[model samples]
Target: MYKLRELERIDLDRINKWRNDQNLIACLGAPYRYINEDVDHEWYEKYLHARNNSVRCAIVDDKQEEVVLGLISLLDINSINRSGVIHIMIGDNENRGKGIGTFAVNEMIKHAFYNLNLRRIELGVLENNLPAIRLYEKTGFVREGVKRESNYKNGKYVSMIIMAILREDYESMPSLRSENDE
Candidate 1:
């Protein structure tokens, strides 16, 4: 297991390192560049300003809450539309492939649907990120479409697949549904 805690100022340093990791940046579909402390601090400030429209959490170890595992978030919340975008990053290589991502993603999905009352949660993943794509599919997210060559990375354009899970989908997913919710 895993648990999610509020993203704190203290977590920024670890996040900054993860953001600047060359390998992670490629999967994130973001331009590769060095992110310094000042830049990350500024980003955190902006995140606070947009709190109403976002819920960013730090995925931590259940036994050792202080041990940061990664980050997961639901952003661009549209109250009227009842939808949001989900994003997750398992910071270090050693921490991945250990079911942590799945646990954190499921927890976030639960929060989105039951807590935030979001009707739909969506995310985009690099086409080459097979592990992540598989994880999302396993969690009941249906592939909507692919944005052909939508992202420029390493001097080339990469395609990203759009995936989403509707509230109805969650209701029918046995692994996600609990008896209490029924």
Candidate 2:
């Protein structure tokens, strides 16, 4: 089982390391931008101070005693509109393809709807990223549209597909909610 918890200052080093991993970088369809110590420190400080965004939750393996397997966030928040962008990164290669990303994302969506009162949650994934797109679809997100040639990586351009799930859609999905909700 995995649980989402607030990201902390101590996790920066691990996060940065994962961000630079060759496989993960390629999966994201972006060239890795290495951050120096100073830049990483600055980034952490800014994230710590930000109010509108939430760099929430390192998905931890419970049996492993709080080992962070991945990171998830709700960004570009618009409180008045009750919406935000969902971002996720599964850092540990060993932990990938284990359904942890789906679990983490679903938890974040629940928090966004129930706690944050968010009406809509959205994300963008590279068109070629089938696993992520399938995960999002499984979690109630529907493909809204595509942005052509929006991402340039590995000497090629790829389309970015937009996916979104509304609160009403989530509320209607019986299997998605825990038994306590009804």
Candidate 3:
């Protein structure tokens, strides 16, 4: 139903627009970011092309116009540690809750563990984003801990919840471990 495609230059515009969406950015633990086309162009030139420590992909829905349903990526991939942090966003609220995020996440995690041979994958979630927290748990991520008063966004301080799924934990979950077999 969905596949991960390398993020090309064309995708920067779409991703930049997605980030500007209030709903999408509101739930992110990262500081609210605003970007214009020039910024995106610069980002593509510096980071996307560098390929130093990350892998980024856009989630494409086969049933649709092959539009990017969202993005799923592995950031800060440390070859020495064999670990990376998962970063994701289900582009639009309308495209969410339809199993799209879960599908993309499972595929990325499978690639991270089996293909990339990474040992650990982790993510941070804003405490108020209950839906995302629940989604992470359902996908096999265990609650690791929390960063108290991590950031002051908008008006108040919000805690960041840290969660992770070890290589062993992901392998044991039969459902999330075999996207390639499909």
TM-score each candidate. Answer: 0.95, 0.92, 0.91
Q: Which digits, one per residue and each the tens of the lDDT, describe model 3 over residues 17-125?
A: 9877776787887667777889878877776655768888889977753598898888899999999999899887789889988888888888998889999999999
Please name the candidate that would achieve the greatest lDDT relative to the true structure: 1
RMSD (Cα, Å) for all candidates, in order, is: 1.5, 1.8, 2.3
Regions of model 1 farther than 4 Å from truth: 177-182
At residue 7, give the lDDT of candidate 2: 81
What is the C-alpha lDDT profile of model 2 across 1-182, one tens digit per residue? 88888887677788888877777887784567876667767877887788556656788877763588998999888888889999999998788899999999999999999988899999999999999999999999999999999998777898999999999999888785666576
Considering every candidate listed, which one attains the maximal TM-score? 1
Q: After superposing candidate 2, which stretches have Cα over 4 Å from the reference?
A: 29-31, 177-182
Q: Which order, best to worst by lDDT?
A: 1, 2, 3
19-124: candidate 1 lDDT, tens digit per residue:
9899888888668989999999998899999999999999998898888999999999999999999999999999988998898888899899999999999999
The 0-to-1 C-alpha lDDT of every candidate, in the order given, reads: 0.91, 0.85, 0.85
Flag regions of model 3 displaced more than 4 Å.
63-66, 174-182
- Collision pairs in model 3: none
